[model samples]
Target: MKLYPIEAGNFKLDGGAMFGVVPKSIWNRTNPADANNMIDLTARCLLIENGDRLILIDTGMGTKQSEKFFSYYYQWGDHSLDRSLKKYGFHRDDITDVFMTHLHFDHCGGSVQWNKDRTGYEPAFKNAIFWTNEAHWEWATKPNEREKASFLTENLLPMKESGQLRFITRNENNFIEKSELDFGILFVDGHTDKQMLPHITYQNKTLVFVADLLPTAGHIPLPYVMGYDTRPLLTLSEKAQFLETAVKNDYYLFMEHDAHNQICTLQTTEKGVRLKEIHTFDHLFD
Candidate 1:
């Protein structure tokens, strides 16, 4: 089995929102904010190649939103989903499974795109099965008022409409009942309801796709949870348990939203579990 890091694109979000109630004085040190108080973020996806299956975990927010809609997020960067796929001698059609960690726009927007006529939406990966859990599918489709803005209909629905959507009826631990995908899934609810963090065993190491649960290295601390989460207090407890497990199991965290660092390791520190080292995807196995 082999893994590749796919660069989707970069965007910015209010540092305050990203850091939640954490003081700017603290988080700004690791994730420095710009003059506008916006912090850099990336929609970094993972491509897994195990035998005949080429599974993609999370497609970054696609380029379908209007300029006005994008202006709010401060979209910036030259990286794109299609170009990134080409970098690895792959194409969207090569993807047999598109595993979504969650249905947030930044994470799954690339699942659909405009048809040739631009009359309606279509599945971005024409031949791939879009994978998401039943609980999250319902949560995103009938989004609550707080998360409605992030759950756009265009980013969803089309995959289901295209008859390519498949639901993973997971256990309480979020493991796919009959998962064919070659990875262990750790179900987390701190960031969102039933966010499946893929635990890929590669080269004698477990590389976990740390989705919004730990957006960046700066979020290693237990208190540095995102305000976008519906249950902040629950996030604290979940993070603590996850971090402990990560440290105990010697897992390599594949950060999905960290712009500068692609992967990180945690070390037990006096304060708490802190970042031990940072590595690029190429250097992870080396």
Candidate 2:
């Protein structure tokens, strides 16, 4: 199997919001913030090639939102979803499966696009079966006030409308459970409800698609949680448990929102879990 680090684009978010309850004096050391307290983050998605399936993990924020909506995030960079796929000798239609970690705009917005005439929305990858949990699909479709802003209807509904939406409902422990193609999972609910973290076994190594659970290296600590999460206290418990597991397993965390580092492994220190190594995707196997 081959894996590709697809760059979608870069955007900024309030550092304080990203690092909830954590003091700026601590998080700012690694994730430096601007005068407005926003920090640049990368919308780094992953693509996997196994057997006849060409699967994409998540698409970054698409370019369909209005300028006023996008101005809030301060979008920047040229790495688009289509451009990244073309670089890998493929196109959007070539994707056989799209495994969205959740329905957040930054993670799933690129899955749908506005039609040419602006008449309606359409699945970005028309031929692919978009994968999301049934519970998550419902939660996003009728999102709460706190999350409604992040779950735009245009970014969703298109997959179902196009008859390409499917849910992975094999079992509850989809996290520790092994997927059909020998892939593993780590289901985390701290960041959101049931965010599946795919653990791909490659060349005697494990590459974990860490969604918002541990967004960036700076979020390695148990306390560095995001304010966007509905359950912050639960987040702390979940993070502590996973950090130990990631350290014991020497798992390579594929960060979705870190701008500088692509992947890293954790080491169990006397204080707690700290970053052991920061390396690129190819470097891990090279």
Candidate 3:
């Protein structure tokens, strides 16, 4: 199996929102903010080429949204999903499966796009089966008031309407040994309901796609959970358990939102689990 780090795009978000309750004086040391207080972030999706299947983890924010809507996020960068795919000598049509961690706009927005005529929306990857868990599918479709803004109909519905949407069978435990995508999944709920974190074993190493559970390297300090999380208290407990397991197994964390740091590993410290090392995808995988 071969894995590629796909740079979908980059954007800025409020540092305060990214690190909830954690003072800027602290988080700023790792994720420094701009004059406007927005910190750099990227939609670092993952692509796995396993035998006949070409699976993409997340789609990132697409370009279908209006300028006004995008202005809020302050997107900046030339990197795009199509361009990134072409970099690997592939295209969207080649993707057989699209495994979405969650249905947040920034994570799965690129799954659908405006048709050529601009008359209606359609699945971005026409030949791919868009994957999301049943619980998360329901949660995102009928979102609560707090998360409603993040779950846009334009980013969803089209996948279902196109008849390419499917759900992964989730197990009762926190981790699934093997999923239909042929990889392990760590089901976490602290960030969102039933967020599926892919645990891929490649090149004799376990690399986990650390989605929102740990957005940036700065968030490794336990208390620096995102304010966007619905259940902050639950996040604390979940993170503690996951961090402990990550340290024990010496797993490599593939960060999805961090713009600067691509991969990281944790080490047990007096303060708890802390950043052990940072690596580029090429340095470790290539």
Candidate 4:
């Protein structure tokens, strides 16, 4: 199996929001904030080429939002979903599965795109089966007040409308067999309901996609949970357990939001599991 780090571009969010109760003095050291206190974060997606299946995890914040909407997040950088795919000698049509960790806009927005003629929205990946959990699907569809803004209809609806939406919950093992991208699914609810993290074993390394549970290398310390998480305390417990497991297994965490650091290894220290080293995806294959 081959793994590709797909860059869907970069955007900025309030640093405080990204790092829950953590003080600016702490996170600012890692991802230095701009004048407005917004920190640049990469919407780094992952692509897995296993046998006949090509799976993409998380689509990044799509480009279909209104100008006013984009004015808020400020999506910048030359990297994009299309360009990154082409960089790997592939295109949208080449994708067979889109495994969404969750339906949050930044994570899954790129799944659908607006038509060129502006008639309506369409699936960005034409031939791909969009994978998400049934419970999260229901929650996103009927979102609560706090999350309603993040779960936009334009970012969703079309997948199901296109008859390509499939729930990942039908499997007893919590994975699809034919989706030979064999990986253990680590589900965490503190950030969002049933958010799945792919614990992937590839090329002699055990890698875990550290979704919002661990957004950046700065989030290594257990208390660095994000304010956006629905339940902050639950996140604390999840992080403690996951960090322990990651260190115990000597796993390489594939960070999604961190712009500079792509992968990191956990180490056991007197304080407990802490950030051991930061490296890029290419460094791993090399």
Candidate 5:
């Protein structure tokens, strides 16, 4: 199996929102904020070439939204999904499976795009089966008030409408030994509902695509949870359990939201689990 780091795009989010109740004095040291209090973030998607199935995890926020809608996020950089795919000699049509960690716009937005006629939206990857669990599919479709803004209809619906949507059979435990996509899936609910984190064994090491469960290396601490999370207390518990397991197994966490750091590992420090090391995708994978 071969792994490629796909740079979907970069944008900035409010540091306060990203770090939750954690005071700026603390988080600012690591994720320094801009004059407007926005912190740098990236939609770092992952592409796995396993045999004939080229699976893509998360598709970043697409370019279909209006300028006014995108101005809120303050997007930056020229890195795009097509450019990144071409870097690996691939294209969106080449993807066979699109495994979404969640239905948040930033994660799954790129799955659908405006059709050529501009009449309506359609599945971006014409050949890919968009993947999400039945539970999340329901939750996102009928989103609560707090998360309604993040779950845009334009970013969803089209996949199901296109008849390319499918769900993974979920297990009762927080971790699935092996998902239909041929990798372990760690299901956590603190962020939204049933966010699936992929635990892939590649090149003799375990690399976990830590979605919002651990957005950045600065979020390694137990108390550092995102304000967007519906259940912060549950997040604390989930992070505690995951961090302990990650440390024990020496897993490489593939961070999806951190613009500066791509992959990180944890260590058992006096202050609990802390960042042990940081690695760029090429530095470690290549």
Candidate 6:
């Protein structure tokens, strides 16, 4: 099996929103903010190639929103989903599965795109089965007031409409173990309902797609949770337990939002789990 880091694009968000209760003096040291107080964030996705299946985790924010809508996020960078796929000698249609961690606009917006005529939207990965759990699917479809803005219809409805949506439920043992992929799913609810993280075992190493649970190495400290999380206290507990498990297993965290740091290892310190080392994906995998 081979894994590739796909760069969908970069955007900016309010640093205060991203850091939640953490003071600017602390988070700013790691993720410095711009003059507008927005921090740089990347919609970095992951691609896995195994046998006949090519799976893409998360699609980043697509380019189908109105200019006024996009004006809010302040997106920048030339990196694009299409361009990233082409970098790996593949195309959008070549993906066999799209495993969405959640249905937030930044995470799954690229799953659907505007059709040729712009009359309607369609599944961006023409031949891929879009994967999400039943709980998350329902939560995103009928979003609450706080999360409604993040779960846009244009980013989700088209997959089901295209007859390519599939639910990744637990097996008899209450674990997601797909024999095709060299990984298992770890479901957490702190960030959103049933957010799935892929715990992949490759080349005698366990590399986890951290997703929003641990957006960057800076988030390693227990209290550095995102304000966007629906339940902050629950996030604290989840992070504590997950960090302990990550340390026990000596896992490599594949960060999705950290623009400068791609992968990091954890070490148990007096202050709890902290980043031990940082390495590029190619530096470690290649």
lDDT of 6 by residue, 20-122 (tens): 9999999999999999999988989999998999999999998999999889989898999999999999999899999998999999999999999999999
Worst-scoring 10-residue span by lDDT in model 2: 172-181
For residues 90-208, what per-residue lDDT tens digits would candidate 3 score against the true structure?
Answer: 99999999999999999999999999999999999988999999999999999999999999998989999888999999777878999999999988898889999999999999999
Model 1 whole-model lDDT (C-alpha atoms): 0.91
User: TM-score for each prediction?
Assistant: 0.97, 0.97, 0.99, 0.95, 0.99, 0.97
* Model 4 pairs in collision: 20-227
For candidate 4, write residues 225-267 as lDDT tens digits: 8889998899999889889888888899999999889999989
Expressed as tens digits, the lDDT of each residue in 1-286 for candidate 2 is 9899999999999999999899999999999999989998989999999889999999999888899988999887777888888998989888999989899999999999888898989988888989888888888898888888888888888889899999876575546567644577667776777778889988888888888998999999888999999888988998888888888888899999998999999998887999999999877765
lDDT winner, 1 or 2: 1
The best candidate by lDDT is: 5
Q: Runs in model 2 with CA error above 4 Å? A: 174-176, 180-182
Give a tens-digit lDDT track for model 1, residues 1-286: 8899999999999999999999999999999999999999999999998999999999999888788988988888899989999998999999999999999999999999999999999999998999998889999999989999989999989998999999876765545423657677877887778888888888999899989999999999999999999899988998899899899999999999999999999999999999999999897664
**Model 4 CA deviation exceeding 4 Å by range:** 170-181
lDDT of each: 0.91, 0.88, 0.95, 0.88, 0.96, 0.90
Off by over 4 Å in 3: none
TM-score of 4: 0.95
Give candidate 6's error at residue 70 in angstroms.
1.7
User: Clashing residue pairs, candidate 5?
Assistant: none
